[model samples]
Target chain A: MGNLNPIQILVDTVSVGGLYALTALGLGLIFSVMRLANFAHAELVTCAAYAVFALSGQPVAVAIVASVGTAMVLALATERLAFRPLRSADQTTMLIASFAVSMFIQKLLIFTVGSRPKPVDPLPILAQPIAIAGAQVSLLKLATILACIACLGALTYLLRRTSIGLHMRAAAEDFTMAQLVGVRANSVILAAFVLSGFLAAVVALLFVAQTGFVHPRLGVQIVLVGFVATVIGGLGSLPGAAAGGFLVGALATLLQALLPAELRPFREAFLFLIVILVLLFRPNGLWPAPGLKERV
Target chain B: MTAYAAAPHAIRPAERLSEIWRRSATLLVLIAAIALLALLAGQADAVLQRRVIFCLVNLVAVVGLYIFMGNSGVLNFSVVGFMAIGAYTSALLSMPAAMKGTFLPDLPLWLGAMQVPHMLALLTAGVVPALIALLVGFPIMRLSGIGAAIATLSLLFIAYIVLGNWDSLTGGQGSLMGLQTYVKLPVAAAVAGGAVAVAFWFQETRWGIALRASREDEVAARASGIRIPRVRLIAFVLGAFVAGVAGALFAHFQGTLRVENFYLDLTFLLMTMLVVGGSRSLTGAVAGTFAISLVTELLRQTEVGVTLPGAAVTLQTPAGLGDVALAGVMLVIILFRPNGISGGREIDEMWRRRAGRKHRKLPEERNA
Candidate 1:
């Protein structure tokens, strides 16, 4: 373990965490406004990956645009079709419906593209590597980190500065009050979904670039991770989700590095155990909302 | 309580008889039809017998789901994971040494050293999952609403990841094989029937009533002195036990098991069955299971040459198109009639009413 490359590990962890944070931000945004978990967020990520793969022959900018656009469409469609009707229904109904939609979209993907995982070619810009702090890191890793930071900065700016962002925050705080203030609650919610979708697209590209493949079931895995991150950071809190995502990612990487050779395969289980502990002790999450009573 | 005494004793005796008649009629008819079909279609080949056994295996799982979802209003997404635990446990216990050694060479020295009887192995299988559920449910039951669901989903993911990676015990991605297939149709059906009966009896008990009340209004139930978490834990453990039994049956019936087969897809299917069948009634559970299974089978079978007019489509479908379609339909039903097919009413309730009507008519005729 001592002989392992520390610099490489740090770089890798940051890159991975950046991707998770980006994806989680989108998921968190939708959750904050709509109070729906958006289980299909991972599928939007996958759709982005597919979009990139399909447009790989084009310039990198076009490919990225295509991926993000595809995810936006998915986000809007999911909100309009699956969630809007259930907005007034009980929480359980919406949760179940989300699960159903997840299944539907996952199976539809399976039907369209066989169940097998497909290799996705990374863009040429992602291929170049740069040596930093005695560690060789792919240019894409740096780009992903920068992209995540830039997007988060933009999101923070939108939320704190812009009128629409203020409306979104208002809706998040109290939907009825926001509506009374002449905020189009539904449109604000839709905007959150769109933003989340775009974030998922970016994360999807990063994931495929890192993992090299995408499958129908990939979304389920991502959604679970996103959910865990959201819970750990505190549900309905965007910054917390980002922080949680990075924390989980860092912890997972450290655990992997520190684990005895024989227990290396159980790395994920160990990480989840940590999550369980966090949940058990702090049911409201690491960064619970101030002055807000958590519902049982 | 005084209202009971106000009812005439003579009328009670007549009502009891009528209730029995009403409750048993549908079950009796269904049983007779099945029996007749079994007799007429005598000596069904091994493949068809296996298919029937498979349906019964699913029936057991759906019934297990009915106990919690039907009575408690908890959407338990971890049943499939519990089933996986049961399947892998049974598979490890029942596998021949040669097969076990070949696939799971890294199995612990003690486990590799001994071979257990198949029946004991199967029993251990069911017990193991139940025990795990009991342990897990303690903390999980404290969570309410979507929190519980998320916790259970976490459990499912953890179980699946463990099962998939734990190559020593489960053979990992490689299918667990070489188990003796002892799950005949009659045995599977009998087990399923027994599960339904147990669930039915449980539903009538005090604990069941408490659980139902909690489901209706947790605050009111708590105010009424119901230990909500304990009741939920009991439901979770019991449901998990039934799922384990189903898994054991499924493992033996298929003669092999794979971790992937019992993960998210199967979990969704089970949830669909419970929801589509009406999460509030035992009859809905059984009916939903049979209906979904038969429809799935029919769709898979009919995927040959059917095509719709004015569509550039073929009737050809994949292996589990029926399940996908059923899930979609169930989603629609959930959207429109969230109470499900039978809502909360059991078949026995309808039968009791019909029997009471018949008894009243008999008295009228006698008087005439």
Candidate 2:
């Protein structure tokens, strides 16, 4: 573990970084459009994970489809039922409401499914180690990197080229102004939720493949890391979210490789300390979004 | 911003006295309510009495949370982190030398040999966390809105990791046991009442008022020459002090400490209490803790299958329903009453409004 193999470290960093980036995008998309932090985004990831586990008996394709469908439906439902009512309320209220939704789903999952983690191997093939440049990297890591790039590229295309995507971008830039200019608030928001749900579903698949288990809290830690990435990247910036995720992921991996054995257990503490230091220097984040600056 | 700012010079001495007297009513009412609950629990079985003590501990923590979040309008997620710091600090200080020697054998001689009085230990608990908060808040409080919240959340995770992994000092995730359990209902209630009074007093001060002004409109507050970050840092440190005391109370109450206790679950539980009551006012913090504790108690009873006095049926509820119901209640309250059940007004405000309505037949006097 002490050996500093460049290829292995690079693969590990990119794989972890890619997953976090996807998670950040899912959260960042919603925050950009609605100004809601959407703590319930964790529930979307968890529901998708559970769906895959529950449908593991089915064909792999069916399990994947069901999980993706589950995340999307749950995301839409939460937006409709919990968030829509608080649209006119302040940001703090929305954040708390989302927290309640997240808790409700987590507890409900525990009530029905129990808190113990259940192992599921929906894709054993991806776990196989493949030789790459004198380093043994799991096929899952390669797949994760590919998936992250594909999703980000596809999302960028959608935002740049499509009418609905343009509407979303406009809304994110300025909500009230976008409404005045004829962007449909409801549909654009719904589209954002759907796309976020798709990203979360992808994250769930990749995360479960790596961890080999599904549990109620599978999403809690990752979602928090994602939320932190979103903030450090720049709250309302898509590309910034990606950058923050990669930065956090790379730092964490590097810390894991470099810290002494006794200090390794404190890696997250060091990571968070660095995050605070970053914010101290750049209070607005590394790539602050336009229109987010505090104005007199 | 000027309209919302406190009129420091407008009130005459007599009027200021009356206004202070009126605000005291809120603190008095809160204290009386807490005393009433403690009194009732005193007569109940040990279990219920313990639960009430725990509620009061939560009240202290939530009120500490309110001191910063209510006034500054920034969600602080690191209160539990401060609480963890407090708990560990208190436990390490108050534990008997023999116990410490056995558990934390590798401890430095000066720290390991010390065995302080419980009160002194508790005071140190509050002081240490406040010092830590002063250091952490200096940088983090400069960021507003989500940036601040995220930074504080990281603080919490950092605390959890450090406490969980510091094996020599913290017993490495195993419980730190055999501490003096001095937090009886009276001790807890006294601290809770004291926290309420401190919260009220702080919010009425110039710094607190300026913080609230910043909370309402940051740009306007900045334009009015208020230093937002300084006031925020003040409240953050003071709030950490209160949270640390609450943590000490929790440690003595439980007679054991675990890093897990001072993590996400406690963080969210205290948050629910603060927000469900109202994060903007002291009354909201107290009321939310009281209401949620009552609801959770009932749910827990039902989960254990409560039997009526003479009925044959047992009212059995599935386990884990308490958490789900608490979350649901918080969701409903946040939706229907975003300012909480207190609506962000103090008890004195509600009282004055009633009196004002009654005096409508006469010519109106200037409102304080």
Best by lDDT: 2
Measured over the true interface residues after superposition, the C-alpha RMSD of each candidate is 2.2, 1.4
lDDT of each structure?
Answer: 0.76, 0.89
lDDT string for model 2 (A1-296, tens) is: 67588999998999999989999999999999988898888989999999999999899999999999999999999999999988877677787788889999998999899999999988888989999888999999999999999999999999999999999999888888899999999999999999999999999999999999999999987898888788778888899999999988898899999999999999988878877877888776688777775445
List the candidate 2 regions with Cα displacement exceeding 4 Å: A294-296, B1-9, B357-368
Q: Give the Cα-based TM-score of candidate 1 against the true structure.
A: 0.89
Residues B348-368 of candidate 1 have per-residue lDDT tens digits of 555555567432322113333
How far out, in Å, is residue B194 in model 1?
Answer: 1.2
Candidate 2, B261-356: lDDT as tens digits: 998778889999998898888999999999899899999999999999999999999999899888899888888877788877788777877776
lDDT of 2 at B181: 98
Docking class of 1: acceptable
Q: What docking grade does candidate 2 earn?
A: medium
